[model samples]
Target: MTILCYHSVDPAWESPLAMRPGEFADHAAWLARHRTVVPLSEAVNRLDRRGRLPRGMAALTFDDGFAGVLEHALPEVQRHRLPTTIFLVAQTLTDEGLDAWWVRTPPPWPLATLTVEEVLHLRDLGVDLQSHSWAHQDLPELDEDRCERDLRQSREFLEDLLHGPVPFLAYPRGLHDDGVRRAARRAGYSHAFALPEGPERVDEYAVPRVGIHRGNNTRTLWVKSQPRYLDARHARRHVARTGRRLLKIG
Candidate 1:
């Protein structure tokens, strides 16, 4: 099974994380035709249970609770009738118009975040809301106690808001270490996700995701949707980053 990570979808925005509405629509249509899209929980459950995931199984996920998702991405998702999930920074739910760390202090353009009512509206639209962490801080950089606290607060707030269990997490900035993973386990998340460059050992707590960006077309999207693509990309990036670090040390 494959899980995809997306952040924003806007026509005017051209950042690495923002995808044009047309591109998103195309990707959604491609997935609709090529894959059996399922809910995030179902994919994770099958992975956890070691059950055989159906052929062409995939899931859609958005991170950071961006409002563009509701504006642009939602319609495509609805048109395709795909099940989706959004990982939210818990603190941002109550803080409308508050620019997240990425959008603050010299952001290229205003990046609007979703409010509580808006999130509830998405929930009404059948989108599962999960945690991206309390403050969207880098978990790997925090102490064990602080990391656990942040993760717990994120889950607690979302569970309260959603009136159900919030069992999944997508690490802030796709960054995590062993201690951070332990903190997530202690914080009670059944699984967590990172970008394609995640740790070598793939498990529930460090699932690799294929991040969809502005430049993705049908060809790139098809390549990314493969079941083996995630691990293979992870291996390549891990080696590349490790080499860079070794060179710096030398």
Candidate 2:
């Protein structure tokens, strides 16, 4: 199954992570035309059972719970009537927008995140809400205790607010290690996501996603939507990591 990841959908913000509304609409329409867009939960279920999705099936996910998603992306999503998921920074629901590393002083636009009201509204609209950690910290950099704490707190906060289970997690920056994955499982997440270049040996915790950036057109997205794209990319990353480790030992 192909899982697509997006960060922000805004016209004014020129960040590569931000795709213009029209472009995102085009992308959404294209997916509606070409692929069987499934809910992330269904896709995860298939992945768990068969370890892959059937051909032409895709899942949509937006990371960080950006306000732009509600403002811009939701209309296109609703128009297409697609099942979508947004992995939110649990703290961002109660606080201001994300405090990210990529933003400069006085960012080009406000790094606005979704509010509690907005999140509840999204949930009501059938958008699946999951954890993106508490502070969007890189999990691999943190020790096991801190990593587990972050994941546990994130899931707990979302569950308390939504009054339901939030069993999925997407690692911040798509970064994780064995310890981090173990923490995710310990924190009660049934599945977790990482980027294309994340670890090989795929399982629920190491599930890979193709990121949708501003530069991705229909053709690029088509390439990404291919079922084997992530597997090939993961294999290459695994090889490179292994080679570097060997060189260091040699």
Candidate 3:
């Protein structure tokens, strides 16, 4: 399934990962007009049942528990009745009050993050909640014990908070290795998501996603959402990577 990954949603924020509310709305409106936006689980079910996603079908996903998603993003998706999955950093979601947890590391603009209560409310509002990581650390850099601990702790915390199975995981920064994937499986995650490096593969534990960033317009979204877009994207990325290697050798 083609899942669109997003981060912060605020008109004022100035980051590639940040998209203004108006632009975000336009993208969703475009999807509602032209394509079918389904929940992550539904797409998976459809893929399993039919061996393919139906034409014009896609899913929405968010990484990091930013408050802007609550303030801006959710209203648009809710208006369209589109299902979305949010992968949250367990430590960033506070039970007390809103804080600067949205800033992964002192971003240029002020950021607000969703609280523990806000996330649960989102789940009640029909958004599926899953693990991003315990502290949003780079999983691949971590070794076996550390990686497994990070994955397991986050899964247990989210499942306990959401009161359901947290079966899916979105890797922090779309980074993972064989060790990380194996850790996720051992932690009880049935599926895992990676950042958009290229097309989505059949790997249940490392399915790639298309990142919908700040500069993307409706046309960009449409093109990226196409079934063969990732195939073409992967080819381009492969060529560039190979060229860089060859240049180094030369």
**Best TM-score among the predictions, by candidate number:** 1
TM-score of each: 0.90, 0.89, 0.89
What is the C-alpha lDDT profile of model 3 across 48-121, one tens digit per residue?
A: 32123667888889888788899999999999888899888887754543344435434665677787778889
| Model 1 lDDT tens row, 1-250 | 5788888898887666778999999999999999998998888776533222455988899989988999999999999999999999998875443457744222376678888999899998889999999988878889999999999999998999999899999998778889999999999999998874533556888876778888899889888877667667657777787565321000
Clashes of each: 0, 1, 0
Each prediction's RMSD to truth = 3.8, 4.4, 4.4
| Superposed Cα deviation of residue 53, candidate 3 (Å) | 3.3
Task: Please report the candidate that would top lDDT against the real structure.
Answer: 2
Please report, in order, the local distance difference test score of every candidate based on alpha carbons.
Answer: 0.82, 0.83, 0.78
lDDT (C-alpha) at residue 27 in model 3: 91
Estimate the overall C-alpha local distance difference test score of candidate 1.
Answer: 0.82
